[model samples]
Target: MADEKGRYSNAFTATLAGIADLFRKQKNAVVLSDDDVITGKNILITGASSGLGFEAAVQLARRGAHVYMACRSGIPEKGEKVMQHTGNRNVVMLPVDLSDIESIKKLVGQLKEAAVKIDVLIENAAVVPSGSRKTKQGIEEMFMVNYLSKFLLTRWLLDNNLFNTDGGSIPRIIFVSSESHRNPKAFDWDGFGKYKEYSMGKTVELYGYYKLLMTTYANELARRLNPTSQHRYSIFALCPGPVNSNIARESPAIFKPLLKIVFGIFFRSPKVAVQPVVYFAASSDVKDKTIDYLFLMSRKEMDAKATDVENGKKVWRLSEELLNQHGVVFQKSFPPRI
Candidate 1:
C-alpha cells in the first residue's frame, strides 16, 4: 500500500478505504482522541438541534472546544442535553432562523456580545421541503435556508471579523453540502420568485439545485477571500453521504416507510456520519485545503457546471442582490477577480 514516497500507493484505493471507514461500527481507523484535536478552539455549528450537526457538536464539546450551537429554536432543551451528554459546560445555544435574514444579523450581534473568537464555523443547517415553500422574505424555503443563508452568514461573519478574531490563528469554514447536488435539471434563475407550487418532483429537484449552488458559491467565495497564500481563512464544502436523518421528512408519506427501511439498512447513522465532518473541523491536515468540494471522506470534484466561473460569479452577484433586497448588505473584503 506504500508508494516510493512512503504514502499510499493508490489514491483511489485509499479514498475508497477511507469512505468505507465511515460505515464501520466503531470507527476503528480513526486514531485522534477528542483532546488531541479541537481543545480550546471556539467552534460554531449551525443546526445543532439534531442529526449530523448535533452529533458533531457533542463530539467537539467532548474535545474541550467551546461549541456555540446556532439553532432556530429549542435551545434550552437541546442545550441542556448537549451539556450533560458531552460533560462540557462550554456549549452555548444561539437562536436564529436561517430563513429570516434579519435573524442572521441578530445572530452576529449575539456572537459579538459573547466575545467569542470563532476558530471553526460549520454551516450545517439545511431543510428539504416536501413541497415548495417561501420564507418570510418570499424566497424559496430550501433556497433561502440551504444556500442563501450560508452565503449571507459567511459574508456577515467576515465583514464583522467574527472568525479568527484572535488575529493570528487561521479559521476554517465547512459547508455541509450533499451528493444530491448533481440534479440534472437546469436552474431556473429567472423564475425563482414565481416558483411556489408544491410538486414532489420540483421540490426534490430544488433541493439538489440549492445544494449545488452552495458549491458554486463556495468556489467563488474562496477565490474572493483567498487572494494569497497567507489568507486567514479557508473554505471546504462536503457531502456527508446518505446519513439516516430527518432531512428526508418531507418525502411523500407513501414512500416514507419504504425509504426508512432502505435508509436504515444501507445508510449510516448520524453518529457515524458525523465523524468525517468533525475530522475536517479540527484536523491539522485540513489546514489551508481551501475550496475543495468533497464527498464524505475524500475530495471529489463537483459537477463540472458547478465550477463554472461565470455561473459562480452570477450566483455571487445574485446572492448580494437578494440579500440587499432583504435589507442586508454584503460586505466584500477582496473583490472577486474573475
Candidate 2:
C-alpha cells in the first residue's frame, strides 16, 4: 500500500490542500443560529487552553453551557479568561496530560469522584509533534494524544456512567477530526500501537493514519452506542479545516516565518474555524442523529475506509487489545457484536 493516500502528505502539502478547500463553495453549509442555546448543559472540552479548543470553550460558554476545560496546561488562568470574555462563570478548568495513560485515568477518576455528569463531551485534544516521541507509557506521543486518549477517555466515561444520559437531552460526543483522515489509503495494522522513531518528514503521514484510526473509532462507537437506530447518543466528528493555531508550534525554526505568513494569509482563525464544533455542541438540528460529520461548515461524508463496518470493528478490537496490553482494563460489558 502507499505510505499515504491523496494529497496531504506533509505540512506544506496539507496547508495547500486546506487552502484550496476553503475556496470551494460550502453548498451544504448549515447555519448556526443565535437562538440555539445550551444553557446549563455540562460540556467537557479537552485541549481548551489554546487555539480552536480555547475558542470553542469561549463560544460554548457564551451560549450558557457549563463548560469544563480539560487540558494539559493553562489552568485557572484559561478558565478565568473564558469567564472574563464570556461573562460566564460556569467554566471550570480540569487538567489532563493527554499523552500519558495514567494522567488520562486520573482525569476520568477525578470527574467520576466529583460526580460530574457531562452532557456534551468534546474530544478536541491533539498534538502535531516535531518528531516521534514516546509518552510515559512508551507509546508514540502523537498517537496517544491525538487518538488513543480519546478512545480511552470516552470508554471510561461510559463505563463509569459519567455521561448524563437520563436527562431530557441526549448526550453528545464530538471529535475534532480532520479531512486529512481521508489521506491515509490504508492502516498500518502490523505496526499498530508500536513506537518507532521518525522525524518531521514522516510526521504528517502518520498523523493522517492516526486520524483514520480516530475517525474509524468514532463510527464504531456510534454503532455500539446507538444500536438498531435507537439514537441514544449523538456521535459527531468534523474537520474544522485549517485554523491558524499553535498546533504547528513545533515546526522547524527555518520554516516558522514562512509558515506564519502563509497561515496568516490563508488559514481561518480559531474563532471562525470552530463553528462546526459549536454547532454540534449546541444545535438542535443534530440532537437526534446517531452520527454526523462536517467539513468546514458543510455536511460531508467521512472517507469510505472510516465508514467501513469491518474496518471500524477491527480498529475497535485492536484499540481495546492495545489498552489491555498496557494494563488499562475495561470493567463493564461492552457492546455486543454488530
Best by lDDT: 2
Write model 1 residue lDDT over 1-338, tens digit each, in one string.
11212111222222234345456454223323354567789999999998898998888998889999999877788889989998899888999999888899899999888777789899999987777777787887787888888988888888888887465687888889866566534556785434467665556556667877888888887777776776657788877776877877877788788778866876788987886678778677666576665566666777765778887888888778776777776555557764
lDDT of 2: 0.91
True-structure RMSD, every candidate: 7.0, 1.8
Q: Please give the CA lDDT of all the candidate structures.
A: 0.76, 0.91
lDDT, candidate 2, 1-338, per-residue tens: 24335668888889888999899888788989999988999999999999999999999999999999998899899999999999999988988999998998898999999899999999998998899998889999999999999999999998899999785558999999999999986788998899999999899988888888999999998888877756688899999999999989999999999999998999999999999999999998997798999999999988999999899988888899999999989986457445
Which portions of model 1 miss their true places by more than 4 Å? 1-35, 165-167, 192-195
Residue pair clashes in candidate 1: none
**What TM-score do all the candidates reach, one by one?**
0.86, 0.97
List residue ranges in candidate 2 displaced over 4 A: 1-4
